[model samples]
Target: MRTIIIQKRRQAVFIGVLCVALIGIASPASAAIHIYTIEVDAALSRMEVVARFAAPANAISARSRDAGRFLLDARDCDNGDQISNRGRRLTISGNGIRCLSYAVDLRSAAQADQRNDLLHASNFLVTPTVWMWRPRLGGDDEIRVQFRLPNDVQVSVPWRPIKTTDNAYLLNASPQSGSAIAIFGHFDSSVANIAGTDLRIELLRVAEDIDAAPIVDWIQETAYNITLAYGRFPNPAARIVVFPIGNTPWPSDSPVLFGRVVRDGGETVELLIDSQQPMQSFYEDWTATHELSHMMLPYLRAEQRWIGEGFAQYYQNVLLARAGRYTENYAWQKLYDGLERGRESVPGLSPNAAASGDERNSRMKIYWSGAALALMADVELRQRSHGKESLDTVLDQFQRCCLPSQRTWSGAELFTTFDSFLELPLFMNLYRQYADAAGFPNVRPLLGQLGVAVDDGEVRLRSDTELAEIRAALTAQRYTGGPGK
Candidate 1:
């Protein structure tokens, strides 16, 4: 009966189209061609979006939560059809409509400060979710967005750049961990080359004066640090957004206040920094290094966040040491302290449970359990292959096969995939022993075997232990090019 109904509906639609064609009426054009002309005002706080659809669209929407509130007006550009604004989505239903235009007040939707810091200077930082509203397209289809910016106003976005013009980009589906930031204001922008990756860096405008060269150098150094894992950086094109929070009253003496890796439309490393801090302080801070380390793996599921965070935490210390920012002893000491914190955060909870449980107090456990396992895996791989196979080699293989992925990955799946890169299975064994059944993967025994002795929280490195060579090799600068690494 359902098949018969579908057939009748199809026949009626075909007959209607045939009658329209016989009467010299043409069918609507295909919906694959979408062009968005985004106009930014001279003040850089308002955006007018004119989305031209090839055919009438049934649904059009913005992507961010509460983004609909900023829509000042929405109407069909051709026949003035009514458009509905419901939360983050906009709905349009009309015949033979080709254009939809909307105006958004970017100042209201822009984030004044990042990471809960209220004292920073008021600057415009609007993500793409706040301003871009268009018809949804298929996975294979892409939208061409052209920005018409006023003079003295610059824009920064994470979309792929189109070569013919400076302000046009191609937008496609992405694994949106968070909103990809779009900066439209007076800000410093430049490109830095790391291996073959051309990293676009945007430094937000602030009251305090900042030296751009040193910050670029610091970013370059961090990128080089990540290349120690593999010969090249993970993504060919990534973005870095720097928000200055130094003028604000913050207690930390460190240069970087906070950093996070947001894999939205593209991979973006957002760094909140103290611009007043000296150049050396920027290089000394591990926030950028840790954030960049996250790019080595695809975005994991929320329940499997331990693996992502742990891998980053482990790599931060090791990579910083390789970059010569941290002494070998200091790196080991930090790792030991971190693993100890993980072990004590929730005594009975497993890594998976800790990640899924209340994050208020179990944050340490969620961050470090995977780090402990990473250390075990690295040490075991190095021991088995006699310096040929380490965590770096396994990750190299993983990156070559699957990276810049568009989907979320479970921890079990990630580990099983990693296990496929080796002669013997190693990652799943570690996951099985610790992921759900452990307080923490007991790394104390492994530490002792690696000759990382901690006396009163001070790491003492010894050369005579069984796995001492592997410990040194993990932090040693193997890929030496570009900067300190």
Candidate 2:
């Protein structure tokens, strides 16, 4: 099962490959190797990066597609030729350049980052999209970035770590889901080994003198909780960045305030938390679980974001119930309440429209519309296979074939891929019926059949219904059998 990466994130994969083939200049395929060595200053104020290409390259630039993001003070390493044009693209000579160097004014970049100013410790974050400049890696192409850091300083990057080497990582092609961040200096970091996976955890230092032990423990526990999904976490080596923005201008009630899974160079879960809260509060917050669950699928297109958000929303409660944090009745009640909110919000917008609509108006619809679809598909799959098939098993098969896909996918594409793992198609039918309709996915009757009854805005679960066992199985935790854990 080779990883299949469709295009539309960075330089569009097909176009890039075609460009490589056209702009041959007779360069060998092996000449595509790029080695970037970066040295960080002790003050966390600046970085000096040197990129050495195996063969001369004509065009080399940062991976960020956004305008106004460019490397600073770039120059040819061989000669003192400066890269004067600073409009995002970096090229030395029309002929080609073998070695290039650049300097990063880290303090400025960190200041530009909204949350970095809140980090009052020895650490500061400047997203790598600003500093990591290199050529496009095509077939068999690779880039190795080695970091030379001061003592007591640790670097956290969204790239695959080279186990044998220190402070080195391999950056391959990725969906570039959001700009992946790079943290430098004295950030508290560690590796949490859970379910045969090694998750790198970076806890950003904040104003308060917080202990990192309990917070890391809570993260490890949360990761373990997600393992109950289909027996293990999705990505084997994912990065978790914990930003502790204590009671500041941006205030949030949640212990884990906000969490997002970004798959730039690799999958990284960024969690914003209020460190003043007790450890138990973190466990109780659904933010971390919701974010972690996002990794179970590929990055969906921004227009079809409901699929990702809804799937995560659906799993957050179900996984919580399976982990015993939420009782089955409570989970059903939560789902029922969420569906009501979604159905009531954005009167004429469909799930697709809601997902692409203004966040201020379509929040509930965007979140729960997909949840409704997930629930429908899960129940249908179970009913079709007589409890032998489920969203969990389908996702498990997907992980075996394609879990961390390197490209953004349409809602139809994602569902079609999932349907491939079954005897009959399931997700696309649901998609076609409700995706563009100017109404929320109608699942109320289905809920009734599944033994979910609502009385006076409260959910009551009944076991005597036709689909009672399947309803029960939805929240029941299955044994983590076999090798995944």
Candidate 3:
């Protein structure tokens, strides 16, 4: 039935082409596209959205167009009105069309009917109206929208009925650029509201520290490092809302101390950092940079959570060292410390076992410990490849191949990809042992190759070769403190 309907519409569009051409293409012709916009006001914790079709006057009716049924693809929470009721609303309006039936992606028929009725009688014609509520939990939300048009004009928005898939909408159609799209509401929040681009963000508050110049400089430096290493912005043109919550008495794990990413509305990335933390210090700045890196790995796809977390951790140090903020020794020391801590947490956990899922126990072993292993793998790979092909290149390739989608890769898949970039398969074999086994593999020997020595829980240089190389790298780069320090 769905295929038949599509075929009929295709045929109708073909026949209507001659009529459309004869009517002249000067006036804006509505295409059979889907149009959607989400508006969010963080101050009030409210949101709204409107999705409708702007078709030509010769289009069909609601019944003919599948009874106005639309798919709601929401993430981060259950797909229903419970979350949407929290200061969120959805409104629909069109000419000569009344909504007949509505269906949410994962919601039951009863729930769908209730929400649909709410929008049916509501005043959706009002601009900047309520669309839908964001779920309370911090994650992502999407809606698979289906609607009807009065005529056979232009279908501008592409219909995406799957919740897991991203919904793309053409936000702008200019003569110069032709067309620009907003993916999964991952539009530029700064300009989304003004342009009705289905992307929005709110600044909760600025950092209390008037001397936030250091933090800002650190952010820019991190961005610069990403570009230098990968030839692209960590989050190119993406919206990042920073909230500076002043000195909190509690620790970093406090709910108020952490930031959140609102995945539902447009790919919104929120960061909440404690101003009390010394922003000038390598520790504090690294935290900020690491969190910010999450914006780039938007989909949380890598089965080895360490790929995301570990890379961010490694880069935080690399960028800081490059910017003369931290010495190469300091950066390597940090990596060494992280590795030891991870090893202690899970004595014999294999990398494969660690990368399997996101369970709490698994996360500790996988996200933290696994991250340390990845760093070791990276260092080994760099040395083997004579620094010509480092982990940065591997990540760049991975980003090109696997990012922006919540696709998971198994341990084997990860190794295969990494092996493709390397001459020897030593790293692959090592990675498999740690990843697939439940026991931890010995990485102390690998660190030896880099001329690093671990003495009674301390990571330091064993000989002049390692010490000289590190010193040279740092001296050549002129290692200093972070920006504005």
- On lDDT, the leading prediction is 2
lDDT of 2 by residue, 282-400 (tens): 87778998999999989988879988899999999998888777889998998898888889989688888877777587998889999999999999999989989999999998888
Top candidate (TM-score): 2
Which of 2 and 3 is the better model by lDDT? Answer: 2
Query: Which 10 consecutive residues of model 1 have the lowest summed lDDT?
Result: 18-27
- TM-score of the candidate numbered 2? 0.88
Which stretches of model 1 miss by more than 4 angstroms?
1-33, 53-56, 78-80, 94-99, 111-123, 135-141, 483-485
Cα lDDT tens digits, model 3, 1-485, are 99846744553454354234333322233333323333322221222233333331112222112112332432211122221111132232233221111223212222333322222221111111012221111112222232232232111221222222222222221111111111221111222221111222323223222454444444445444444445554433344444445555566643225543333322334556565666554343565555555545543334555555655666666655665556766766776777666666555556544565545565545545545656566666666566666666776776677554333345456667667766676556766556556655466666675566777866676555543453234223532332222
Compared with the true structure, all predictions reach lDDT values of 0.78, 0.80, 0.42
Per-prediction TM-score, please? 0.86, 0.88, 0.56
By TM-score, how accurate is candidate 3?
0.56
RMSD of each: 9.1, 8.4, 12.9
